[model samples]
Target: MIGLNHYLIISGLLFAIGLMGVVRRKNLLMLFFSTEIMLNAANIALAAAGHFYNDLSGQMFAFFVIAIAASEVAVGLGLLILIYKKNGTLDLDDLATMKG
Candidate 1:
């Protein structure tokens, strides 16, 4: 049967991929997507652990994480929109001019 180990392995792999994406991508939008991916990986792992242990605690914690992630996305996207309005591009290097 599918087990906690399998779930953990998959979660770790997904988190690594997300981290690599965040590190490699230059676009701010893609960076946000990568962060979302990492959050999802955590969710998967938490849910799996909750199920394997026959407890609701982990699941509830995952839900809280989901809520926080959703809020983060909302605020992040709003800022992105503002940034896009102020600047014509979303490139990280292009944003360097904003710093002192």
Candidate 2:
């Protein structure tokens, strides 16, 4: 039967993959996606722990996290759109040269 350990292992793998993407990807969109993946991994772990412990705190925290993630995505996408409009590209390496 699946247990907390299984959930935790899956969460760890997801978080690791997300971390790698965030570290190695050069595209701004991919970086945002990676961050979302990491956030989802945290949500999964929190929900799993809440279930295992029969407590509400972890689940509540996960709900708050989801809300925060939603807001972050909205703001981040807005910024990305603005940046792409100004730079005509979403490549992180190219964006590094942008100056005021």
Candidate 3:
């Protein structure tokens, strides 16, 4: 049967992958995606724990995390697009030169 341990392990793996993406990627868009992955990992873990413990709080928190993630992706991508249009590149290093 699927259990809390399984969920936690998956969550840990997801978080690790996300962390790697965030640390190793140079594109601003990829960094945003990595952050979303990390957020999703936390949500899954929270939801799993809620189910395992028969408590609703964890699930509620997970929902909030999802909402926040959605908003982040929207605003973050918008900013990335603006940067790319202005700089002609999505590379994080390129963005650093933004002086306006």
Better of 1 and 3 by lDDT: 1
Q: Evaluate residue 59 in candidate 3 and report its C-alpha lDDT on the 0 to 100 scale.
A: 92
Which scores better on TM-score, 2 or 3?
Answer: 2
Query: By descending lDDT, how would the candidates be arranged?
Result: 2, 1, 3
lDDT of 1 by residue, 1-100 (tens): 8889999999999999999999999999999999999999999999999999999998999999999998999999999999999997888889898687
TM-score of every prediction relative to native: 0.93, 0.94, 0.90
Off by over 4 Å in 3: 98-100
User: At residue 23, what lDDT does model 3 achieve?
Assistant: 98
lDDT for residue 95 in candidate 1, whole number 0-100 = 87
lDDT of 2 at 52: 97
Residue 92 miss distance in model 1 (angstroms): 0.9
Q: What lDDT does model 2 reach?
A: 0.96
Off by over 4 Å in 2: 98-100
Give the top-scoring candidate (lDDT). 2
Clash count, one per candidate: 0, 0, 0
Judge candidate 3 at residue 39 and give its lDDT.
96
Candidate 1 yields a Cα-based lDDT of 0.95
